[model samples]
Target: MPEAIQFVPYVLVVLLTGIPTWKLLVRVGLSPAWAILCLIPAGFIIVLWLIAYRRWPLLEE
Candidate 1:
């Protein structure tokens, strides 16, 4: 039980950031699953690069 309590804050952070990031990724024409990268070290930088280099679906349409 004590061990499980330790994870609560981590889980909350993931949920808080991941949910909004997932939505934004979808809106930007990237896969929502990419939001998981935000939880990783320097992963947000990767996602930013992906958005910067890739063509947006909205723009293509």
Candidate 2:
């Protein structure tokens, strides 16, 4: 049971980072679920590159 406590902070961190990331992706016309990528090792970089190079839907208008 004690070991489970160690993961609480990590879960909080993921939620803190993920919620805003999800919102940002949505605003940029990407799926909010893409924010789940940020939870993986080095996945934030992958998402960053994808967002940087991909054309935003808002800009198309």
Candidate 3:
């Protein structure tokens, strides 16, 4: 396996993605428990909530 690189930019991305993900769920009227999971891959989001939250803002066609 290739060694993982630990750089400032990569760490920043992790913090940026993880923090507001918690807040976004509240804004959307969803439970806090689901916010952290929002940080997961978009494919999982699509699969999990497809029938309800059908609009995928970031996903490519």
lDDT, model 2? 0.84
Question: Which lDDT tens digits does candidate 3 get at residues 1-61?
Answer: 2345546655566467656655655555555566455445573364346325744344434
Per-candidate count of clashing residue pairs (backbone under 3 Å): 0, 0, 0
Better of 1 and 3 by lDDT: 1
> What count of clashes does model 2 give?
0
State the C-alpha lDDT per candidate: 0.83, 0.84, 0.52
| RMSD list, candidates in order | 2.0, 1.5, 8.4
Ranking by TM-score: 2, 1, 3
- Candidate 3 residue-wise lDDT at 22: 54
Task: Estimate the TM-score for candidate 3.
Answer: 0.41
Off by over 4 Å in 3: 1-10, 38-61
Summarize candidate 1's per-residue lDDT along 2-49 as a digit string, tens digits: 999999998888788778878878888888889889898588778778
For each candidate in turn, the TM-score is 0.72, 0.78, 0.41
Query: Candidate 1: how many backbone clashes?
Result: 0
